[model samples]
Target: MNTESLLRDLREELDDGGLRGSFLVRDLHTGQEIGLDADLEFPSASLVKVPLAAATLERIRRGELDGATQLEVEPGRVTTAGPAGLARFRHPARVAIDDLLYLSVAVSDGTAADALFELTPPAEVTRMLREWGIDGVSVRHATAELADTPAERFEPGEVHLAHALAIRAGTAGRGHPVSQLDVSRASAGSARAYVALLEALWRPSEVDAEVAARTRDLMAHNLLRQRLTPDFGSDATKWSSKTGTLLNLRHEVGVAEHADGQVFAVAALTESRVPAAIQPEAEILMARVARTMRDHLRSR
Candidate 1:
């Protein structure tokens, strides 16, 4: 099928699935690309961790911060919303900066991310990205702020109401009643911007090679693999990625390196109109759509 027809079909499919997203896939070698609303911005939930990791490593490389330094982290000191890492610890633990990077990026640990944020504030992370010549991704707040949404107020059985509110409360300008969902108020990025980040990591340019390599390694070790990993990962391919999620938003950005030396950077940032969470079908649809784009680019 031609590009126009394929994009039209993909748009229809996403609408049918009650999803609206910004997706981009770019061939690293040739700079060729394809997308659906790639420039549309979405509140970047945990996705900010990637930049956090990069900035932290950059500081380490510059001898400003030592990765071997250990910090005392108290249990439940940060947000308890996360399902993994230091968020679940029952007691205070002293974790090294390097291990904290692993927990923050690879495990999507909100507490660990906030811990890192303490060392390098959100504004500092944004400054670091600017210094690296990365744009379109804005880091405005820490991970702890992400846990304070309406989703947390609702009873477990009625959490869908929060999702419903998330779906219905957005303005055409992308403002939201919930600060965490508002692009202006929350950390946000476009698919193209994230794909650019992936490109920088996969093919270092403005970002230092060592920092990018370490960031890429953290993504490769990511434990949250149920989203796009199934489609992009295989024996013949290596998929390195980071996932971000909030009330109704789900996103994943990664690089797929084929054994044949072809590398494609993909970013899928999506918001669901569906009220219910835990939509495995939505996750599957996202992966399929992104993989289809990758396959298309590969063919050309």
Candidate 2:
């Protein structure tokens, strides 16, 4: 039941499942933790939604934005990647703030994230992190810069040149590898910052009440299918979360607050050899940790 034994068991489970790198799990209330390759930074997919959502709402609290404000998805704004919510619409989307937040959290909509990213550029997102008193975070590449991704990284300005370099140097504005991802629009984040965001949310003193509430509402609406939710874990525990995958990455992060107030915030992520269609295997590995942690807490 201790962290060392718990970590040893998790490593075995992930290895048996053929997972890559590490996953992180924490005891939010007690400050205890179990990590298998947790600190190793890997690309955070939709997991970035929590921060982006908090940043947008933080702006609203500052009067920099009106909560019900709207943005028109001009031809240039509409994109085919990410979640297909409005894209499923018959015409270009002129989504309101509510709808954008809904689609972003509910479905991990790439387009929705781009919309928010458009309103709050990555550099500005970093600013929000500092203002909120969160640390170990940096976001410099605007989601819109995705447009400059070279058709190939070998050729500068390809799809992900900006992002690729950023990830390598552990900083944003560096560059992203394009050619591989340039074909389609994409974005990235880190696990450490993601949890910091949730920690901030769980204890909203870091930001205004209105901002925390709105962001929580947005996340609440966006429910991800995970091992603990109705969709994946066979009704084990209800989870309001974001699920993400691409190439080799599989991830999910959210607050799992039980009826008893034994809330646990988990960020389970990994790079994997599994194909995109079956990436949930990595999540399943993380879920094993979640189930165990939940058991330990219940025993208390």
Candidate 3:
């Protein structure tokens, strides 16, 4: 396919919308990355689940957490509206660690993430990331990275578990104070680093193989829609991803596998004053960029 033409087309579409933000797309195979204000960070929203999932598995690897650890569903912890809406467990159903992580990522389950955090929490996860060379993660909630972590003073040892679980619980339109600005303060992402994180999660040569594989496995089962690969191509185009949207932000960062060992890392973050009910416009913006990146990979 002619990728350049598609890129031009997508760029024009983005321009027409006048949305505010950055984007980044890279061909993992050829190592070519395209960026446009791609460093701007929006709320990770649910998108932060990707990294938090990695943190959970990494904890399991260290034996600090048994993915099989069970947790109970508690009131005030599980929102009445999100993935944890059914709430009526009085016995404290001890959910397994892996299951909790899966629920948190795949379904963006709030109670599930809360259960996991109660086990190992966010401050600890931030510590692990520091050892892993990850910087600029706002030290917000333990569940994800986007809305909570203030970019300027990321801490490896603060209680971020509650913050982590909130976004996953399906709370929409909430914004943190640090999230009011770009450059880490406003909890946003540039297309470049966002895609970089996905590479670290899916492609082993790019990140720890065990962590990447485990993370990919989690995403495959936690899809909210039949978009991307299935929407654009086929098994010839397999995508492992997690998306985030809240208030004025909409983002999706993931890995897509194409024919002939071709892989691509894409991050699409957009912002608007409209609410989540109007998120489709944001989706259209991201889809244009993602499709262009996929096409770009095939051209290689």
Candidate 4:
């Protein structure tokens, strides 16, 4: 099918699936690409961790921070729960800076990310990205800030109410009553921006080669595989990715390397119109849409 018809059909499919998103798939070698609203920015959720890892690694490379340095981490509150990693720690433990990077990216550990953030503040992360010539992604706060959403205020059974609020309370300008969901206030990036980041990691330019290599290694070990992994991973391919989620929003950005020496960078940033906390179908739809874009780019 032609690009126009494919995009139209994909857009319709996303609408039918109750999702609106920014998606991009690019051939790292040729630079050809395809997408839907690929430049539209959204609150990045845990996606900010990738840049955080990159910045942290860069600092280590500069000898400003030692990867072997261990920091004591206190256990997270039960109320501010997370799915895995340091957030669920029941006791204080000392973890090295390198291990914290692993927990932050591989397990989506917010506490580990915040610990790293203490060493390299949000402003410094942004500054490091700019120094490396990466743009469009802004890191304004630590991962702990993401846990303070209205979803926390609601009962677990009524968390969907917070999702509903997230769905309805956004402005056309991307402002949200919930600061975490607001692009202006939250860590934010577009699919295109993230794809650029992936490209930088996969094929370094201004970014330090060692830093990019370390970041890529961390993503390769990412355990949160329920998003784009199903569609991208296989015996013949390697999918290195990071997932970002906030109320009503789901996103993943990664590089897919095939056995045939082909490489592509994919980024999907989405928001659901539906008001549920767990939407398996939404995850499936995101994977399908991203895979479709990747298939199209490859076929060309």
Candidate 5:
């Protein structure tokens, strides 16, 4: 694959659409790679949950955390949006830690993520990744604190659309016209950094093998596959990944293993100039770009 030429083409295409993004694709087994703005940092949205879950599972493996521990539902922990699990709870309830982990990653449940974050703070997760040699990745806060703006914060009483709109209105500190914070202060990582982490998850050397496998298992069940799944061609392509979404940013990073055992780690992180919270075109562009990259790598 002519990675250099491909990236140049991608840059021009994205620029034509007023979209800016970062990409890093590496053949895990061969180590051949390609990237575009791969070193630039972007918000880690729900993608941060991957490492958060990984760190939590590692602690459980080391006996620092007990998966069987039960946690009580508090008012602040319930997120305004997301799937069943913590967000759907109507009353005070106790949930097992293992279930919380599943909800956090599998379903991108914000409430469940906050619960895990309480057990494994962002700093600990960041340190764990760095220790494993995954550099340029920084997890600074829980999903709850990533908002950096009052309107963007998960207020249990507030409507989800309003919360999202506030973020789109740029109520926070500094950002492009679309959102207050296009990038997250809570968690930030470059595409290359995420590719490194995905490589470790695919073939564990620095991290615990069992824990890494468990993390990959959880990510493989990721409910949000609309972004990059279509490009992988068929169900035969195994994509174990994590996705991140904010007001204007959309990202997915994971390893795609073909039927022949060929493996590639792909990170597609993008920011749209459109101000609307819902931009279906951005999502489509992501899938198209990923498909183009995947085909380039596979044909090689």
Candidate 6:
């Protein structure tokens, strides 16, 4: 495949839509790769949970944590970002660590993700990535911090649209007083770095084989496919990914496997020009880019 021309075409496609972003797609089995702005760091949004899940699973393997361990779902941990899994509960409910991992990664459940942060702090997650030789990635704050970041300096409450519009306009999260949308202030990683981590998750080396297997399984079961799944999802092709959403940003990293034994790891992270508080175009563009990369990789 002519990767250079593919990227040029992709740039045109994105320009037509008035979208800006980064992407990295690798044919894991062949080591062929292609991307545009793959090195640029973007706000992690919910993508940080993928590494958090890997760390937690590895700790369980080392006897540092237990998958079967149960913890209560306190109301303070809940957030409106994800499904009503734990948030719908009327009373404090005890949930297993295993379930928490599923909720955090598969469902992008902020409450469950924040709960796991108490066990494996951001610092520990960072250490795990470095120890595994993953670079160009930074895991800094908890999902709760991401939730409460807006309230830190500017507030009235979570003004999701107002903040999103400001951030999309590149005025909210830039310098001086950091906003939640700031890439530097938030958990962030490049598309290349994420593809590297996905490589590890699929074929284990630093982490235990069993742990990696389980981690991949959980990620494969990610319930929300609206980001990457809609493009490559089919009976012959399997698309599994973790999605990250905050204001105008929509990101997802996952592996797509064809029935013929060819596998590709792709990370598409995009920030839209659409100013709407709820921009479906951003989400659609993410899938469109993934499909473009997938088609290019498969053609080879």
Please provide TM-scores, in order, for all candidate models, with all chains considered together.
0.98, 0.76, 0.75, 0.98, 0.86, 0.89
Instruction: Quote the RMSD, in angstroms, for model 5.
Output: 4.0
Candidate 4 local distance difference test against the native: 0.93
lDDT of 1: 0.93
Off by over 4 Å in 1: 77-82
User: Which regions of candidate 4 deviate over 4 angstroms?
Assistant: 79-81
Per-residue alpha-carbon lDDT of model 2 for 86-148, expressed as tens digits? 534555767787677777777766567778888888778768778887765555444334333
- Compared with the true structure, what per-residue lDDT tens digits does model 6 show for residues 1-300? 478887888888887776777898999888988788998778888999899998999899999998999998876433344344664455777899999999888878777887899999988998999999887677888876655544334333545545555454564434313455666777888899899999998875787788888988998899987777878778998887888876666889999888989999999988776555466676787678878887787787
How far is 190's C-alpha from truth in model 5 (Å)? 0.8
| Model 5 Cα lDDT, one tens digit per residue, 205-225 | 798998899999999898887
Candidate 4 lDDT for residue 10: 94
Sorted on lDDT, highest at the top, how do the candidates line up?
4, 1, 6, 5, 2, 3
| Candidate 6 lowest-lDDT run of ten | 171-180
As a whole number from 0 to 100, the lDDT of residue 271 in candidate 3 is 63
TM-score top scorer: 4
The global Cα lDDT (0 to 1) of model 6 is: 0.79
Off by over 4 Å in 2: 75-82, 142-190, 227-238, 297-300
Pairs of colliding residues, candidate 1? none
Give candidate 5's TM-score: 0.86
Tens digits of per-residue lDDT, candidate 3, 1-300, equal 355566566667776764555667787767787666676656566665666778778777778777766666564332222233213233456566777778778877655665666665666755655666665444346433332333213343432433333223332343444334233343344566677677666555434678878889887765665434334446577777776655445666677777767777777777653323344555666676667665655565
Estimate every model's Cα lDDT from 0 to 1.
Answer: 0.93, 0.60, 0.59, 0.93, 0.77, 0.79
Q: lDDT by residue for model 4 over 31-132, one digit each (tens)?
A: 999989999999999999999999999999999999999999988755544557778878998999999999999999999999999999999999988887
Expressed as tens digits, the lDDT of each residue in 3-37 for candidate 1 is 99999999999999999999999999999999999
Clashes of each: 0, 25, 27, 0, 0, 0
